[model samples]
Target: MELKQETQTYEMPHLLTYYECDETGHPSMSMLLSMISMASDEHSMALGMGIEKVQATGGTWVVSGYEGQLAEQQPVFGETIILGTRAVAYNRFFAVREFWITDKEHNIEYARIKAIFVFMNLKTRRMESIPAALIEPFRSPIVKRIPRLKRPQKLNENAPIVEKDYRVRYFDLDANHHVNNARYFDWLLDPLGRNFLKTHRLKKFNLQYLQEVRDGEKIDSKVNKLIENQKITCHQISSDNQIDAIAEIEWY
Candidate 1:
């Protein structure tokens, strides 16, 4: 079926807090992703598809991947920003959602991101068809083909790469009983070190999740050493002898 030109949207105002920001006093990439995620949950709740309702179908929504661009000028702690999201389109197995963060007046966009989500069976821990009762309330069109996001480039394994290992902690899990999608950003970028992160700002990023990272797992995050003239970096996260996720980021 063809989707409508207009889709349901939801927006809310959020006040940035000190904890959400880094040393630059601006919201960090991980926290920025979390804010938009919060908006998505609120959107679902407004449509009467809260966690309880969705979980009743024996499955929950999982973010498969995200692609986004960040404005050079970002919102700082103590600033009020608007978080907005819309149900773009969906198929039986995948749904695309768009999100944005802007000043309260909506004059300047701080970040714009699009995420692809899949319904996953909690018990089986595998992909499942999205139930109509959980998704139809948003009124997004059902399409035979859901548009795919740009894929991130893979890293050169033989190249000089920096790697850091982190153990999955209890706090990393969200209500879905899986690692929170936003936490991956911290692992992906941390290998770049403090100096680089403080000096550069992210312009664009694409993150693809190839496998799930479970609790107590010791995961290795690796990134190619930055080239002097190149502003792009490739990252990979691996655990249990498998590549769990990969990301490509462009910096300013």
Candidate 2:
């Protein structure tokens, strides 16, 4: 019943509805995260660890952190895409998973993500060791030896950089009622503008959430291009500059 590292490939049909683009029409960041979630579900189902089975075991998977970067040109709506995922590695408390969004033609990679996950005892809301049965199916040895990603940089209190404002909306709240974690990506990346967004696909990403964003509040987003390789971005939902989230993205 020990969990194993595994890899799975899935074909994701492009849904036009997901292209709720911004002022510049393209796939939105929120929709990209949603598609990644769907791909994760499909990967789990393929390994026979679908939601029903996890619920039956009285435990569930929870995302701890995620890092992803966007490629400049995302496939427009109605384009067929392929989403692939693999169980990279895991330790006692943390599991690492990798995913990619690619064109159906296999010529381009639109996005890539690395995420950390933890198992929770649904009743107690406490972290639990992942069961062997749940992981064995993944069949990935990469998880065993994979190194931890670097933590994102913190903002300096003395040299503060103020950025644009993001207003929370009703739909931004998920079942948990806080701002949906993925929405932060919009605030984090939008400052770069359409040109930067269109020219580069996310080659690597590292993110950490320090706090939460609530409904109806205005949040500020800041970015620092520390070296071309390390792009640091942060989000705070207050004028006082308390960080609600932070992300580091690397472009290819």
Candidate 3:
């Protein structure tokens, strides 16, 4: 399949707000995801397929999963950065979106991400085919190509070290009353610590959601660094032992 260059580019100006930073004085993983969401909206608007047009078709784009890698920990409160995004490709049921963050000079890439999106019928609340009119403006090919993202592989439980815990927070709930999907990225990546996080940038990531997290319920996050380029993480909510999500992130 022929991969076409992006027809349009969306540039987003980001002001690092204090509330978005973590204890280490850098943007939190959750906040980074928020910035990506903002950039994705701007990209859609540039293509003339803003939120209204998406909803007019009785469907909306829902992020199925994301993979992000950061080169350095972004600073807090005073940095002005540009978030750029482009629509990469789309099939009947899925679409691929790409994003990058660069300093004001645009010389260095602070972070990069690839995401999978699916359209859902607002009324029926089920996955639906992506609308042609909505995708055509992006001008990316509807090719057979799909990203070869790494999948989470099982790890040895008897290993020398492993970490796991459950989380329950009121703020995790979104307007939809379920946990906002992006919050899971925080839980998935936080275990890597500020040391490893500050030193490496994400090269690739793949995530999958299996269940929903509810308000007031505890969710367990399990993580293991299985190899040099791979890490496996999972989220389980409550005593039912239900796995809500799993993700694999690769770093350089």
The candidate maximizing TM-score is 1
Better of 1 and 2 by lDDT: 1
Query: What lDDT would candidate 2 get against the real structure?
Result: 0.68
Candidate 1, residues 111-166: lDDT per residue as tens digits? 99999999999899899999988888888889999889899999988899899999
Pick by TM-score: 1 or 2, better one: 1
- In candidate 3 the C-alpha lDDT for residue 164 amounts to 54
Rank order (by lDDT, best first): 1, 3, 2
Residues 33-99 of candidate 2: C-alpha lDDT, one tens digit per residue: 7678777777788678888798687887777778776677777766677776777778777778887
Regarding lDDT, does 1 or 3 come out ahead? 1
Task: Quote each prediction's TM-score.
Answer: 0.96, 0.72, 0.78
Error of 2 at 25 (Å): 2.8
Runs off by more than 4 Å, candidate 2: 1-7, 16-18, 142-145, 163-170, 175-179, 187-204, 210-243, 250-252
CA error at residue 247 for candidate 1, angstroms: 0.4
For candidate 2, the clash count comes to 28
Error of 2 at 51 (Å): 2.7
Error of 2 at 174 (Å): 3.9
